[model samples]
Target: MLIIALSTNIAMLCLVSAVLQIVLPNDAPQWLIFGNIVVFVACVYYTYKAVTVWPDEEKAATIS
Candidate 1:
């Protein structure tokens, strides 16, 4: 659940960055573009992990 929420938020950030890229002038700073790419990659990784490697609540409960 937490991963889901986090990935969702990251996805939202990626969306916002994409929108900004489209709306803002082409002269956006290099760092901003790099940051957006980094965020997008992170979002993809988290989303993939969430889908493929879900946490086991039973194991989590046992550990706690």
Candidate 2:
């Protein structure tokens, strides 16, 4: 579930970036920079969440 969320977020971010680049003027740096920051923060958040939910295969096998 978390992996799905992470991938979806990243994919959406890329789509947004592409759309913004096509629609926005070349001189506009602010929007692009802001988008980049938001994407970075989202990636960091998802990464942290993913690490927590990730299965510990080694520990599980040992326990079994």
Candidate 3:
């Protein structure tokens, strides 16, 4: 649940950052754009991992 919430927030941030980059291509700082991209990628990877692992976690809980 926490991870889902975090992913949602990060997704929004990425969307906003992308829009800003498009709207202000010349004004947006390179580092900020790079940082946003890194964070977005990380968020996507972790979210996918979490989702894949969730079924295992549920099975473990049910067995216990």
Candidate 4:
């Protein structure tokens, strides 16, 4: 769940940053865009990994 939240948060940040850039100065530093893309990709990659590794929910419910 934490990973899911993190994924969504990073996605949101990427969207917001991109949107803001439309109005931001043309001279804005280069690293901010690069950093956003890197973090967004990492978040999505990790979220996919975590979900695949998590135990089956249906199996756990059936045990009870």
Candidate 5:
């Protein structure tokens, strides 16, 4: 659940960054775009991990 929460939070942050990048003027700092890209990648990774991995309880159930 914590991983799910983190993934959702990261995804939401990425969406915010994307909206800012689109609505903000081009004169916005280049670093902001780079930061957004980094954040987007992080969100993607977190989402993938959250979906593919299991919690302790889940793993124990699977083993039995």
Candidate 6:
């Protein structure tokens, strides 16, 4: 479901960000960090919206 998608997106973003930070030169630009922050924020917003709109039954099923 959407929650899973959002979580995966967040995880991928974090992984990519970490790899970029580790592999990029020490003097590399800050764009990678900024992009990671933006994507993370967007994912969190979408996850909040999905949770708020999800049906009670589905939420319960997810919890269990």
TM-score of each: 0.58, 0.47, 0.70, 0.66, 0.63, 0.55
lDDT of each: 0.78, 0.71, 0.80, 0.77, 0.78, 0.72
Off by over 4 Å in 5: 55-59, 62-64
Worst 10 residues of 3 by lDDT: 18-27
lDDT of 5 at 30: 70
Pairs clashing in candidate 1? none
Which prediction has more favorable TM-score, 4 or 5? 4
lDDT of 5 by residue, 1-64 (tens): 7777887787778778877877877677777777777787887887788777755887799989
RMSD in Å for all candidates: 3.9, 4.4, 2.5, 2.7, 2.9, 5.6
> Which candidate would rank higher by lDDT, 2 or 5?
5
Question: Which scores better on lDDT, 1 or 3?
Answer: 3
Q: For model 6, where is the 10-residue window of minimal lDDT?
A: 27-36
Residue-by-residue lDDT tens digits, candidate 3, 1-64: 7996799689679868866896774777778788887888888888888887776777889999
Pick out the ten consecutive residues of candidate 1 with the lowest summed lDDT: 28-37
Report the C-alpha lDDT of model 6 over 1-64, residue by residue, as the tens digit. Answer: 8675866689577668856776777765678677776776677777777777777987789989
* RMSD (CA, angstroms), candidate 6: 5.6
Candidates 1 and 5 compared: the better one by TM-score is 5
What would the per-residue lDDT of candidate 1 be over residues 1-64, giving only the tens digit for each residue?
A: 7777887788778768877886888877777767877887888788887777875889889999
Candidate 4 clashing pairs? Answer: none
Error of model 3, residue 26, in angstroms: 4.8
- Global CA lDDT computed for model 6: 0.72
Q: Show how many residue pairs clash in every candidate, following the order shown.
A: 0, 0, 0, 0, 0, 0
**Best TM-score goes to which candidate?**
3
Off by over 4 Å in 6: 15-25, 58-64
For residue 61, model 1's alpha carbon misses the true position, in angstroms, by 14
Q: Is candidate 2 or candidate 5 better by TM-score?
A: 5
Measured on C-alpha atoms, candidate 4 has an lDDT of 0.77
